[model samples]
Target chain A: MNRRPVFLITMLCFGFAFFYIPILSMIVYSFNESRLATVWGGFSTKWYVSLFSNRQVIAALILSLKIALISATVATILGTMAGIALARFRKFRGRVLFSGLVTAPLIMPEVITGISSLMFFILLADWIGWPGQRGFTTVTLAHITFSMVFVTTVVQSRMVQADQAIEEAAMDLGSRPWQVLFDVTLPVIFPAIMSGWLLAFTISLDDVVITAFTTGPGATTLPLLIWSKVKLGVTPDVNALATLMVLVVGLGVVLAGILMSRADRRRDADARLAYQANE
Target chain B: MSKAYKTGWFDRKGWSDIIIGLPYVWLVALFLLPFLIVVAMSVATKTPTAPPFSFGGDYPLLNWEGYERVFSDGLYLRAFLTSVVNAAAAMLLCLIVGYPMALGLVRVAPAWRNILLMLVILPFWTSFLLRVYAWMGLMGKNSWFNKLLTDWWNFVVPVDWAVNSIPMMHTNFAVVLVMVYTYLPFMILPLYASLERLDTTLDEAALDLGSRPHQVFFDITLPQSVPGIIAGGMLVFIPAAGELVIPTLVGNSASPMIGRVISDEFNQARDWPMASAVAVALLVLMVVPTMLYSHFQAKSGGAK
Candidate 1:
């Protein structure tokens, strides 16, 4: 047990390298002076300049952000509801069905989900005469449906791990259910909710296949735009865009990591303080 | 307590109802109901119009043609084969690459584990499209990575067989490669979660009783992680089997995967019934493993 399995360490490092190399290459090639993604003429920021100026990409990016924002917010609210219900209620009518629905999306192929939802939307339009076109509304709806799965999973785990005694005690102290919820339950699972929102946002932003199926020609998301561009072949402009996205996502993740660690340490201090005060 | 708060509409029963009922209705309407609709559309006939499958043509309107085509068509069958093969290869490769890494994270000093786990998850946060696109750049003809591989191929293979850059783009090889890369983190995270919970006492006892480390690993660790493996495998396999992006971007067009076939049928051919049929078939194909995965998940008691 004491022996450092050198093989496993090498495998770990190797796996990380495999993950990072393609990302690093994309970043490097984004600065390429040549129009070619792979071939380096000299280091230049011309591609970034063009990428920022590109109206289509800009439009797509803005639309994606808008969808992500809306989807994440709605999914978080709904997912938090579902998570609490699952974690606390223990059993209810159609509980089995509800759990199945939530977890199915987590594993279901996007193509099937995408196609089925598209047909479902079409049927809705034909029958109800609403959502007449598969545009922003349809795409946003599709995103919310799937992205909520991540949110539910995240919040569910957190809710399960959360100490329910506090809520019980709050009720005993004459806190109404809503008061206990808002004051105690919500605060305890706040970080999970935040991360869940973030996950939903990213999932919505990054989706392509489902978005493709549900989106109209008018509603091209960032991933869709990226897909169309990359399908032709790798271009330096796309590389630049990819690099910028990678940096943004990477920074967001690092910031989140730091915040979480700080929060964790603060939690430890709070636990100790609570113990001392109790004594 | 406040009088106004006490008389609020959200009573205890009301609160519970809202919490459970809202998401429940949303899911049934969007998720479960759509699948049933897909099943209905699968057997309908394709007509030439907006919402192409018509209800006015025949009273019963149960055109088994789409079903027949799905059952009998070589293209559909071949596509299924390609998807399964490529996805299976990717799933196996991910487990191979990720298992050791997961074990290492658990084995390493406690201080480094979270950081390493974060590294595994960081890529997952970035745009999946961009991640696949990164591989495209690496695999392109003039790319240094491809050129390096080309040189290696040239060195190893017979002189006549070696000429130019390796065709890493637009092949099943590329599809599987990218799928493995895309899904490696999914494999690792679940494996890590399961492995981290494993008791070391059993391993210590086995080793102290004269069993070798590898023996202890095979006899104790591997058997216990069956649920993890199934979870991870299902996670990787199901999605990879139905992956649309990688196949479209990098796969050989002549040999389309199941996902690409369904997309093309719907988008290009505009055969709604056929697309629905294919989608139904794909869903049916996925049912066995999906059920197994859910069963394992329920037993594992992770999340509902």
Candidate 2:
């Protein structure tokens, strides 16, 4: 029976308050009637009305969703492969370099990555001329580079925890390597892959600096639009937009959490039934 | 063997090789190759024409002006100084604020842990730009939040020291404050991960020997969580140092951060070579801590 100290509990409360107050304030202020972000006017839904009609914001939101979806899917596939290679393969050619490449983006400053990525695209265009303009294609590619690193981390950690015996067992039963992968290894790490995809999706949607560098000529993402607006000053409609984003992303996360926990509970039940059958 | 089976002969080895090689190739080209290009561009001269920079132009093939300017110019030097000082402040503040929280999380009951962890990450799922914008609203002069803080300051301090607002917006204080808010989760998560794995029995045993909690903490718990501290510190420091949005939104332009300067050099000045040089310099600055973190990771991975 350990007595948890009051001081630590106080810090815990303070930490969560610090994290939430700005957000709670933003959401509350979004309903204000006044144009000023800080001042409270009588409650009004006018900003939300304006936000819905804003053509630029709507276009940017659509563009951002498209980029996030494409980048997240591609990043997840590549990241799963990279994660498996790291966790399952004992050794491989250029493993250190591969590992470094996978993890480095997680820590590398955005300014550095942005500058380099932009230059790479330019050089790439000059050489191959495939991605002709710096727009949707370019931004999606840039998002994939850093976003995949997050996917790699999530999948790699999950892969490490997964039991390899099941995979080996499948292989021993005359299943080909790909069959074992699809049947055993993939299923086991599927939760990690799903969460990793979500993380990558969120990162891509939230990005600004890399998107700014890589995008051009009317391919503004939501964050890029928000950045330009916020740069000038805080507007009432921006607050409304922020509140909506928080709602959508928060809902997605909660939904994912429920599904994962439910899946886990079912697995536990199945394992218990299997044990009883053996007895 | 049937002829059809010949294609499957190299299926295991070759297929796995391709599976592994695909990501490796994509990264080397996208991540590694781009980095090399930045290094090469750092040595190229700025031009007024398209591509924005070239080697062996009217000037020497290996132009060192960008690197030279980075070291010699007052703006670059001051920007670097601002970045380091601000990043260091944010890193330490995050540690101060995050350490106790992480410890509290570890000490809590097991059934509550997962839920609390999810709460910690929930904010991070939201757009980062919005979070900074929230601060912008809170810190603005006319805002209710600002008035509350200003009123408290006037009551605490002498009457003559009072001001209309606390001058929070467009200051280094604002930059650091927003950063501490933004990066606190990064600090807490790693610290939690490390502290959670610590042997709790060790704390209980030390307490059994009549060692005070603080003494036990400093001697036992603190040492164990040092790795967590470093991991969190690097995560906070490296990004905060080069952050663009938070600083640009909340920070003063007269004395800008390195990231703002890089953007200006690249966009406003149309000097890709200079931006690349500053980026290369930033990478060189970051490489040491980056390597230390990776080395720690490799060691821990190997031990596992």
Candidate 3:
């Protein structure tokens, strides 16, 4: 037991060092005053201040956030509906197709998805001219397509494990089907929905390949900007940007972790109270 | 319970129908239709038109020329091989590194488990591109990290065998390193999920039955975690195989991966049909392993 724990701790330390060293260096260098990224100079916050003033990066950030938000919300709704249909309406016609479509995106590589969608958009525009040009709308649509699968998988798994008796009891008490869904089913699966939304949001935000293909001129994203900059040459401003993003995501995770632990404690307390009442 | 109340105004069947139909319609339009376009374009001949390909008017509806080109061209074959090799290496490395951490996660005190798991997931919240870029900073020829590695190497090797800096950037080593760093979490989380569920009594029984600790792990823990291994392998392998950014930023341009080939063929060469052909073939290649994974999954699930 003693030996095992030592080995485990050593492994975790090494693994975490491998993961964090790169990120830590990036964050540290972001504060460097040197224009050269690798060279260390006295610490300064000028790069971060410059990052905000850089209209291109700022525009791309806003665009990415908007796309992530809208696509995640839409994907969540559509995916939850699909999840409910899959879990509750098992014997429906086209069930196989429905299931297949839901799982297909999981395995499909982003490159293939990207090229195919780009072609599809081009052909669609040629056919109808409805979207005339590819930009935010096309990027958002592409995001929604890929992200909905994650949402569906999350929601469906939760839905399958959901207590059906509560929903049935609600229905038996003269509640309509919609009422049972809104009042019972939705509440039970709410956590899954929220997680699904988060997953979709993150996926959309991090996406480069799919967005690279689907996006047109003026639809540049943060990843795209970073990619171009890295290709041209690494710069200090990118380091600053990377650091800020790390801080934002780190804060978000900490907040989420705290909330999750609190929620778990509350649930435990509620269960304990009910147990004592029974005694 | 009272008799089931019939819906007087609203039809449950109708609502269910709409709910089911929405995703079906959306997927068919966006997902299915787009894939069909690629398949169609793969058969079309390149043209001077805006979309750069045409299927109708004198040209035959189907042309196997693109497919023929892909098979004959050594570039595509080499790229596919590189992708598979790199992805497999990355997957194996991730497993080697992640398994212990995951095992540790399962063995830790229950109160600390969630906090530890959060630590594993924390780095993932950061931008993946940024993380890869960080590797670029570390692996560059003039960087302090490279200097440290080179200094260590010089100490180990003969004086005559010493060099200034190991060419880490634009090499397979850089690609694999970044990939392992990026996908290690994918490997650990799944492994942890399964390892946590393992019945410790089985391990203890093996230990008591005269098996060594290593023997018990091989005979018990390793066999049990095969499913996690496979899931993690797939999760890492699939993306790593199709990965464009990692290879583009860090990898040697001489031996481009399939992703770069597709991107280059489309964006640089303007060979849309050829790119489509390669993309389709790549999809076909990926599907075989994915299907094998599914088969293994089904077998394991059935056993359970």
Candidate 4:
């Protein structure tokens, strides 16, 4: 290798270490049998055991999972519909407005989003009888607003890559529009739907700011619980919780990647077989 | 059957379009309506000592008091300036740290690339608050690493500079350090995507002519990567300006930033009008840079 490559590699290694060391240290310290998180007081799973018995941590974890699942599923469905409309229909009157509305959450400051949603929910509750006393319902709604944008982007890109000719052919072969959609478009975009669902799930799971605004006293998510606890002081149990979360999220990501790669391989194989048949 | 196949928005035969259109309507109602409410609330005067705050009156649309107070107050102005400055510094730090990592990842072997990319994004999967707490533990005064540093330095040297210089917590430096770490991947990923798409032949051609490596980089690579830089900078800058968590967690309350000011107005002072004014000011400050970045992105044909 050239000297340039060596220099670049060294520089990059330093950068990576700067980013990774603190996080890696947190993971390591979680297993240490010390009340003070910084000290290496022998290896033990005491904190993990304590974390398991902590009611606050357990409740927050369960609530966070429920919020993530519900919001991700809802957002994925809504976003897929929006993506199909945007891709298939071109000359809508409010197209620009709709596009702006969809992307606004992606760029707007979270503080602004949080404050605005809080204000809206308060006012809505005052006027209407629905969504009484903001809590999990409001938090899930806020998450869906933002997470749907990610899902829409993913699904739209996938929809663009799909061949519309197949749908046209299905229609010509005596299939109704709904049947053609079910038989052709749905199957083709299923992978995108899965990816979109995963993206929404992760985004909702990781959200803290918006969830903070909308959550009432009894509805703390894991991140919210961690945040309030940190304000007082650090605890070893939080570290153990963080370690478990990192493991779960990391596993989900790895599994999703494996499944996506498998799908891509199958698609490639099918394409090759189709070409062979034509020859 | 062909006559019934009219695919327009108003055509009733395609009822699926109505279902598809519902999400857009929900977005507008839930997302856009609240934003409009914010705009409305910003301009409306707050009633003195009331349960239900009302914006009703003859001149409901105009409240110069909020805007005037925000501009006239030195503390608010200074906070705004500090936020802009801090965001700029954080952006510069992210570029210095992230660009090289992006370059390395793209050039590395295929087998290592996936794992390396995972490392870059791993932080993003965890709760942002936990990551901040992790940094707090690592950088605290009685932290194990800091203790080790002090002990080692005391043995080797008589000077206490190492111990004194190590900030355990509650400093501007701590806030900036964490901000850089938090946003580093955001900066790196976009630049990496751009760099990966760049043709190697362009660099070869430049070298084939009599261009030095430095010249080729500045002329060919830097210009091409401008879009990535702008995109990444906007990602870091806009949020950093309004960020309340890192500064509140690590820095002193005396450190002026827009986020702290707005938060104080809401929580500590219970002054909604002041908070709204500060929020409006922050939004106004962000608008110019956002428009400029969008224009640049359009010119470069990058994703908006």
Candidate 5:
């Protein structure tokens, strides 16, 4: 059918190569015996061993995971509510301002966000004694503030596309507004919510600049550690750590792909069965 | 009209009000308040006290001295220029590399499209710092990547002009390269969204009217995808300009970007007012362009 254009294929090939080559090289070099990242020596797992032994790296990884988990969960909850208000509620006081807040984080420079939030925390500490210091708690709050914008957009789109009749029907059947939201709307939008959570989690985990501003001493994240270490030079231990992260992310993506395709196939089968019955 | 359904007490409007009010409060406190504080800090005087900045002492409350320094200092001005140049270059490169791939994804068969799109986004899921570090490894002088580039350069040019290595690291070139790599997905996704929704029937009609493929694309596809182009460009450009990680990691330390300057002023020099001034200036630079872009976007949207 001449659908496969030569120019398009070439572009795709080059683009994907440019994207994957650096990461693939890092993974390959992680196994290299040589201390130098580029020089190929015999494969070894010593870097992996060293990465495990480094207590700072391990502590940073744990801290990052904890922050990602807590921030993503809280952001998802807040974002979903905001999404519903924008999508379901026709009119509210200051609706324009609400929408602006949701999208501002998407475009605002990370530096501005980082600096502004740091100031906010310090001001809060001076005014009140709660969160007496800026550390993990402060970083988590900052991440949630920004990452929730992404979550809101995701959930808002899903909610906008969702059928309203189901929720209306539930409400018609004597269900409370909260019940309609919980039983009908939430279930329908659960997939979007889950993906929103994942998006927030990854963003929080990978964040460097914002975390740099918000985090205090003894609360270093993985990216912060890697940044400081790479300033010294790329070590084999960091390469090993990157490889493990790639492995984990790769598995998660492939699993999601498989699940999506299975769902699609099931939907196709259902449609075909209905068509056959009608015939 | 008869009221068919009863509104339960629990389902009343108050529930919705409370639900929405909570997030609004959180945003006002966390997001808006912080920015306001920055604005205040920008106007404050630098002091030797604990917080390092004070609103008023012997000096006037609205101190324009930090902003005066930002405007007069050549170093800060140069940093601003470098940031604009570097970010613009990265944005242009991303557009060039991303446009074709996005077009390809839209044109390809459905079976392979999803997989390819996944590939485009999969790298994004990995840590950005690690990805930049990988470039550092590649661009370093004794690496195979640099050697390969050096060999290619030597092959193309006369032997005398060629050197041992191209010296890729610690330069604006490396910064832009890593930026394009990191932000290519941001450019591609919006572009694909707009490109995929394009009416192919318009292209078919143009072809039937004796237009060539290139002519049809320029006339129909390119004009229609302008929205996507703007969206992608802003997404890449804004972040690339504000970007601290890639520049500090790969860029030459001789001429720091504005983001670096802000960090240095805040952390190293302990100049909160000056850093806040720079931050405020950077925000102004970004916001003006953004407002113009959205204005154009709305104008074009309204025309359609």
Candidate 6:
């Protein structure tokens, strides 16, 4: 066990280097004045400037944000509901079916999901005359399908750990079911819901394969935009854009972790107080 | 109110449950119904005259032609094989690279654990497409990596390393590398979760009983961690098998994977039924292994 630390450190360093070097190279090359990705001439922020000014990149960012926000909200609501149903009412009929269908999107290949979704939408549009054409609506729908799975997993795990006694206590005290949920359950699981929403948002924002199959001609998301540009050749502008994304995502994760840890500490404090009171 | 009546499924209090159940009906309509449509479309005849490549008007049932084409075509079969090999290779690479890192993290000081875990998960937050693109810059013939290796070789070896070495870009190696890199966290996190839960006393006990470290690992640790390995393997293997983005970006057209072929069938080749057939086939292949693994795990009570 004592020898573990030295061996672990060496392995950790190797893993870190393997994962980080490629990313770090991209970041470093983003500042290079040379158009060539290999040879570095001098450092400059020209690529970042170019990236900011690129209309397509800007549009894609906006579109990606729109999709992420819309899908994350919708998926969170639905996923939370499903999670509650599964966690609270475990013996319900069709529970297995519902759970399987919901989680199937998680493991199903993206290409299959994308193509199937696209076909389904096109068929539905023809039949119902709604969601007229594949665009933001379809993209959001696809994103929600996958993102909801993550949200459900997060929410379900939290709900399982949640004490049922509190809700029962509230009900015993003459509170309505809705009131019990709102006052007792919702506040307890709110951090999990927030984490689920954030996770869903990130998944939606990062999706490319699903978006590519579902998105309309005019509605390009950031990943799709980046993919097309990358296909042509590596560009420093993309490097700049990617660097920005990496920073934003890193910050979001840190913030979420802080929020979760705070909630955990609060829960621990509440538990300790209750134990002392019982004694 | 009577207690039994109050707790009844159809009671007034259960109205909220009904409301909660409503959205899942919509989910089934959106997610499950679409898959059914794909299944139906696969069997239906594709009419060139139809606007969106009609699978016939009323009865869009099974079309053997699509299945036949996928099965009979050498190109499709080859791609399928390639996909299997590539995914397996990617899964192996992820395990080799990630297992140690995860083991290390679990053994590290508690203070540094969070930072290390965050670093492991950070790459996932970047736009997946951007991460794949970054590999292009790293693996390209004239890329920084190749240049750096060549420079290092010039310092040590007399021969030109760049010229002798096989180009990493646009090869199966590059595609697999990216796939492994992208999925390494998926492998590591689960392994770490399992490894962290492991009892150090068990290892110590084994050591006290005169077992070597390797013997202790193979006999106790590996078996205990089998569930994690299976889960991690499934997580990485399933998607990587059908991975489109990495292969499309980094892999050559000469040896496309089943995913790329399926995508091509839909987008460029205009063969929807064929794409659906391929999809179904791929699903069947994936489901078999998954089911078998679950069954074995269930029998052994190994999976939590």
The top-ranked prediction according to TM-score is 3
DockQ, candidate no. 6: 0.60
For A219-273, candidate 6 gives per-residue lDDT tens digits of 9988888888888888888888878877888888899789878978998999999
State the C-alpha lDDT per candidate: 0.88, 0.87, 0.87, 0.80, 0.88, 0.82
Docking class of 3: medium
lDDT of 4 by residue, B187-244 (tens): 9999998888889799889989978877877898777877788888888888888888
TM-scores of chain A across candidates: 0.95, 0.95, 0.96, 0.93, 0.93, 0.92
Candidate 2, residue A160: lDDT: 83
lDDT tens digits, residues A173-222, model 4?
A: 77766787788888999988987998898888878788988889799998
> 3 or 5, which is superior by TM-score?
3
The interface root-mean-square deviations, each candidate in sequence, come to: 3.6, 3.6, 2.6, 2.8, 2.5, 2.6
Predicted candidate 3 versus true structure: per-residue lDDT over B1-304, tens digit per residue = 2323432112365786788888889999999999888888888888877889878566467878888877888988888889999999999999999999999888888898888888889888778888889999998887779999999999999999998998999998899999999999999998998898899999889888898888888998998988888888888999899989999999999999999999898888887888899889888877666768757785976598
- Which lDDT tens digits does candidate 5 get at residues B1-304? 0122332222355777776887888888889888888888999988888678988866576999888888899998999999999989999999999999999999989999989999999999999999899899899898889999999999999988989999888999999999999999999999999999999999989888998888888899998898888889888888888888888888899999999999889888888888999989988876667768766896877699
Q: Could you give the CAPRI-style class of model 1?
A: medium
Model 2: per-residue lDDT, tens digit, B182-262?
Answer: 999999999998998999799889999998888888998898887788889888998999999988999999999999988
Query: Which candidate, 2 or 5, has the higher TM-score?
Result: 5
Interface RMSD (Å) of model 2?
A: 3.6
lDDT of 3 by residue, A64-142 (tens): 9999999999999899888877877747788898898998898887888988888899889989985788999999999
Runs of candidate 3 with Cα error greater than 4 angstroms are: B1-11, B56-60, B297-301
Q: DockQ order of candidates, best first?
A: 5, 3, 1, 6, 2, 4
The CAPRI quality class of candidate 6 comes to medium
Candidate 3 displacement at residue B276 in angstroms: 1.2
| Residue A74 error, candidate 3, Å | 0.5
Against the true two-chain complex, what DockQ does each candidate achieve? Answer: 0.60, 0.59, 0.62, 0.54, 0.63, 0.60
RMSD of each: 3.3, 3.1, 2.2, 2.9, 2.3, 2.8
Clash pairs, candidate 5, are none
TM-score of each: 0.94, 0.94, 0.96, 0.92, 0.95, 0.93
